[model samples]
Target: MPTSATLAQPAAKPASRRGFLASAAAPLIVPGSALGLNGAVAASDRITMAAIGQGPRGQFVLGHFLEQKDVRMVAVCDCFAERRAAAKQVVDKHYGNSDCAVYRLHERVLERKDIDAILTAGGDRWHAVMSVLASRAGKDVYCEKPISLTIAEGRSLIEATRKNKTVWQCGTQRRSNPTWKFVVDVVQKGRIGALRAVTTSFGEGPWRQTGVPTEEPAPDPEVFDYDRWLGQAPWEPYSKLRVRLWRVNWATGAGAIADMGAHYFEAVQWARGNLLELPVEYDGAGMFLKKPGINNIPYFYNVRARYRDGMLLIMDPAPKGVRYDGEEGYIHILDDGRVEASPKSILEGLPDLSKLPPPKGHWNIMAPHIRDFLDAVRSRGTTVSNPEAAHASHVIVHAANICLRLGRPVKWD
Candidate 1:
């Protein structure tokens, strides 16, 4: 990884994953409901599960886990009381049992020995933090996108997952979609002629921080441990926007390009046949709106990077999708499950289209990806959206964010 004046190290390790779990042992007791699951045992068929960061995304991911008879969601954690309780309710309701444990801190969940794997859908800052800890604790991980807030954190996260031999999958669920696979295969196999460029877009986000509270509030330790949510992020006074709206802030997330563009460029990397390599250089300009919607992340931006292979990736303002241009034609992929190619007959160009996978029923977006993660857990196989690939795509846009932040184009080493 290259050093930059734009990317600075945080003051210190907020807390070591191992150290936090070890010291919190006395308080983080296993819930009585989790005990005596021995009767529920069905050999290795079941994956004992714990969930952290039970917000909207957390609750959603945990619901998918509970749908499987082979998954036992023993514990869940969230900084907010209402959300965590809501998660436990979902678990308890599913199994018709209150054996599910509730937690405010993720360290408690990590300290538990019962969980085989952890499903995390937390804030962008906590993604890398908890993934590293979960890896250290000898558990597989299913984490959300923009795996880390910065390129440096992503590199370290890759190290942890690789070292622990953890079966890790990022939450860029499109990778599991049969349509996306077919597209990647087509692009990689040169069915679209020689690939030349990729155009990805996510429209525009709130440029001006509005509809959010700007005043820093006193931390309500009882209602929500603001400090815990702010972990790994620099210490700052509690602002409703800072905690909840942190997703778009550069301090806590990589803004739209890395956070949302993660999906777009990741597929670009997949089609480009270089998932782990980043562009050698990138240049970009951004519109830093003075009207505040939330934080400092650009409300709108554009970046262009040239991969070493001379393939160009352009992210411009438009609808949310990736369009690949090649000599044969252009293929456009959207998140809503729309894939289009030029000449109309390009779909027939694939000699093995019959051998390619059939559509997996109706695409719910999250379902297939969850199925892949659970299957990997049972079979100990690699997931299609493993952490390594996530990291590579992450760095692509993360480097772009740096360019916007530093107000200069960057040369990535």
Candidate 2:
């Protein structure tokens, strides 16, 4: 129930569970599952996790984490009471127990030392700050993408993880998909000759807010913590439309370009083999909706960035995925897990695409990615989509967004 300002204070370190167990007055009866017997993961070997935010996307990703046997989801947090209750039900159902804790404030979840990692699938505004707080609390983070609202916030997250030695995984799961791996491999192997350009499509910009109530309505305090939900974002009057379409507003989200562009840009960065570098110049232009409303994001846009090596990265209002263009041929990867290459012969010598296990769904490629994060958490290793790569990819999107907003070109040193 604390305000966001009060929640900013450092959380108290959790008491050691071992100390408590040693001083117990009564002997404890342990189940076979708790002891790792009967084909169960041992209590000590399991990774305790908590989830923040349980919207549709949050619930989808949380379901994947629940599928991992080594991950024990103990808590669920959200600003919405319904979401918290629903998420707790799912967690309890998965473990067949009613012990899953639920909280309205994320700080309560972060204060628990028993939680080894935090899954942040909240709004774009909360992604960076939540990850920073979790890292400082000595918890690993698996955060959904467009991980930060701004380049500065992204850098702050990178620093926080490094300082805390936290294993952070950005939710750009494409890196773990075998299909994407194959695409990157082919491009890296020169099957496409020299990688001269990369092009990707982002959805059309957000439309102007219309057909919504003009007057601010009082929010139900018990049902939703509206103040906390707007954390770090500029204060605006309560509107269901605003909460529903937060991604279209500049305060809470960067736009369609950032929402979907982050994935495509990450792929482009991976293909270019420059996850740590930035393009020297960025130029973009977009058309804005003329309607009078809250939504201010561009409705159409075409953005371009030039790497120092003269290679280009282009993003426009097209379809969903990326294309790698080279001297000899080009390869295009769509969101539906479909792949097309020009001169078709270029795909001949590569690994047999037919042998690869087809993905369950477009976004269902999350299980393997979650597995990678859990492996890294146990081994103290790095994940495929670490903070550095995430930040680099985000920088490109943020810069392009800036260019489009400014209606001019921007340069990076």
Candidate 1 has an lDDT of 0.78
Model 2: weakest 10-residue lDDT segment is 204-213
Question: TM-scores, in order shown?
Answer: 0.84, 0.91
lDDT at position 333, candidate 2: 85
Point out where model 1 deviates above 4 Å: 1-44, 211-219, 291-294, 349-363
Give the per-residue lDDT digits (tens) of candidate 2, residues 1-413: 65433453456677688877776956878899999998889989999999998999999999999988888998899999999999999999999998788888787888876889989998999999999999999999999988998989999998999999999999988888889888998899999999999988874444544435254775786699989999999887888877887877789877878877778788888887878878889998988777666667887888889999999999888877789999999999887778899989999967787777564576577888999999999999999899999998898888988898899999998
Error of 2 at 279 (Å): 1.2
Q: Which prediction has the highest lDDT against the true structure?
A: 2
What TM-score would you give candidate 2 relative to the actual structure? 0.91
Error at 311, model 2, angstroms: 0.7
Instruction: Estimate candidate 2's alpha-carbon lDDT, on a 0 to 1 scale.
Output: 0.86
Q: How displaced is residue 315 in candidate 1, in Å?
A: 0.8
- Candidate 1 lDDT, 1-413, residue by residue in tens: 42221122234557899988888885767644445455554535578888998887778777777777677787887888888878888888998877777777666677666678999888888888899999998899999877888778888888997898888899887777777787888788776799888888887665445445566766677588888877787777777766666766666766778756777777888787767777888998987757645567777778999988888888877877788999989888765656788977777746454453443332345778888998988788888888878888888878888888899989989
Clashing pairs in 1: 208-291, 208-292, 208-293, 209-292, 209-293, 209-294, 210-293
- Candidate 2 regions with alpha-carbon error over 4 angstroms: 1-29, 205-213
